[model samples]
Target: MKVEMILKELEALGSERTKKSYLQQGAHEPLFGVATGAMKPIAKKVKGNQAVAEELYATGNYDAMYLAGMIADVKAMTEADFDRWMEGAYFYMISDFIVAVSLAETEFAMEVSDRWILDGRELYGSAGYSCYCWLLGNRKDEEFDQDKLSEMLDLVKKTIHTSEDRVKYAMNLFVVTIGVSYLPLHEKAVEVAHAIGMIEISDGKGKHNLPVASVEIQKAVQKDRLGFKRRNVRC
Candidate 1:
């Protein structure tokens, strides 16, 4: 989908009541729309809807705090602009928007993720986590199998079921997603690349200054004999 088309839709949803409540008070932030009263994004994130929760958890409150980073042309992305994204989320069309964004300018993803990250913060999630996972997923580190992917997804689902902090799921999703892939995850090194989902890197935390992503990735890989976390992985 074209980013323009997806953007148009996100603008439409901003006028609703549910979205209106999302606006931060007394802050000169860009307006996305009138704000939806039907179902605030917060409602989705905190509902423990793992699908929604995990996705929402990755972005903390960047959406709400769009102004902090000199991001977003407050004028260009007016209330009308925000309404479109709100509308997209209402229909569970976030993935489509994500695809459009993925196809758009590379820098834009951080903006979208940042904006939503703020909302997730109020709702208890982290955008940095999602951004990190997305970063890893986009890398040509390895190929993934269906069963392994399924298992990784299942593991994330499992983590979601038990973890109080949704960010853990975000970290797990990144690891599990790759673990199930055909990467060369190494046991001897602190970091390894191409072990299904493993990527060789140092202790880097994109945000929140938390070292959870790496810790979880290593745990998942080392859980069973330096084996990738993928389930029944084929070759």
Candidate 2:
């Protein structure tokens, strides 16, 4: 389907209750508030439409931007395209999930993650951490870079507390991702999680209570789910 038709459908599907929930999750206005399940059929119809995805993303409507991620051809997207997506990311959902997941599917995953983590911008840094986490979760053990992952753990140990609130949250999730999916780094991730202790984040709506990495890792271990690779990270 065309971008115009998709936009019209999204507008028709918009929900005020869902929009309020999205607001709590950091979404801005000009949104359709379409649910993920509702967007899937549209995504299937528009699959592989890079041009149309770009047009949707450019609209800056929360729903369309999300749909852009769903329909984008990540392999065909240029580094410049990814950079624009990152810059246009307006909140955690768009940055950490949409942009980061798309970037992870590209060859630029490592390079982008490294650059974005050091950017110090909240959403960018969160996207960076999230990209790395998705990489670790999806890539096999043979393809893993142990040394670089170790260095990232050290970086988290040093800077997590002082990082932006959302970055800290992403960093905490990173540790959990390493512990649960990268067997070689599991112990080190637990150590870092213990060293870092509890993490706190807020979106200005309410008190944000994030998961403890060590505890989450332990639960995964108990369930014999360690080193389990996800088929894909993109939603």
Candidate 3:
């Protein structure tokens, strides 16, 4: 309830860097997307009588933990102290959320996206796409981009002509939907698909599968990640 107390505890936790060396070195069996594992032991190493342990696990991981710290004195939190827990996250732990999205958990994807924007800022691109893809499972929906898959395809074609790595990756995942649905923006997607080399020329029956190559998608994503390098622009 007191800002002074919260600040003191946060300083204590932040000062425990030595105790978290193994975590930084990543030498232990990593619990990928986990910060709680890292925080718990560090909390125990605290010298004072601080209830660091309670704050460390108050929520679950960093996001919740930070929230708990801000909302209440974790070392002395009470049920009545549970104010609006999410007071705009101070520190973020996004690894676990990333893993969850890879599993195609739409609920998780959407939820994470929402939280990232509202609490953590816009550091959730991979997860946002995961949510979009999950919602557009099998690539059959035409609602994406105003149903203008074709427009995207066209852009892809142009990108291919220029060998633009970014367009190539995004477009490949844009196509591969063969369902009998009409995406009003199919033209847009078509341009995009062309740019990425996702042109699956069917046998004039619309009965064949919308073939998608995992390798191509992987390469695209890899490129997308690398595009974040200091030499490139932000995604």
Candidate 4:
């Protein structure tokens, strides 16, 4: 479908209630407030349309940008393209869920994510760590470097508490992801989670403690989901 058709469809599918919820979650104006699940049929119709994805993303409408990720041609995107998308990411939803999720499907996933993690910027760091979560949840254990992941766990142990709010959440998720998805570092991930414990994050309104990674990991374990890998990064 054309961009105009897609936008019209998105507008029709949007709801005021969903829009209010998105606004509360940091989405800005010009959004149609269409839920992600509501865009699946449209996504299936336009799958892998890189040009359409780029056009939709350039609209800067929250819902359209999200749908762009759903229909994006990951292999066709270069590091520069990913960086461009990251530049437009104004909040954790777009950063961690959209840009990072798209980056996870590329060969440059690790390289680009490393740069973002070390960028010392909040959203970048959050997206960088989040990219790893996607990777670990979808890719095989042999695809990752054991030593590098171990060092990352150590880094999380040292800096997670003092990191940016979103970064702390992403890092905590990373540890839990390693515990749940990577068999080689499962024990070390548990150790790091135990060391880090519960994380504190602020949502502009007030502060709240995030779920402890050790606890979440154990919950996944109780469900016998150890080493679980998702078949797709994007829904």
Q: Between candidates 2 and 4, name the one with more favorable TM-score.
A: 4
The order by descending lDDT is 4, 2, 1, 3
Candidate 1 achieves a global lDDT of 0.35
Record all residue pairs in model 4 with backbone atoms less than 3 Å apart, i.e. clashing: none
lDDT of 4 by residue, 27-111 (tens): 9999988988999999999999999999999999999999999999999999999999999999999999999999999999999
Question: Residue 115 error for model 3, in Å?
Answer: 10
lDDT of 1 by residue, 1-235 (tens): 2323323444565553434444422212244543333224433323323233223223333232221111222233333344343433321113222322221224444455445534544112333335434543454444323454344344443443333334453544445445433245322122321122322222223323223434655565666433433221110
TM-score per candidate: 0.27, 0.97, 0.28, 0.98
Better of 1 and 2 by TM-score: 2
- On lDDT, who's better, 1 or 4? 4
Top TM-score: which candidate number? 4
Tell me the spans in candidate 3 whose CA falls farther than 4 Å from its real position.
Answer: 1-29, 32-123, 138-171, 175-188, 198-235
State the displacement of the C-alpha of residue 71, model 1, in Å, after optimal TM-score superposition: 26
Cα distance off (Å), candidate 4, residue 28: 0.5
Each model's total of backbone clashes: 58, 0, 37, 0
Q: Which candidate is the best by lDDT?
A: 4
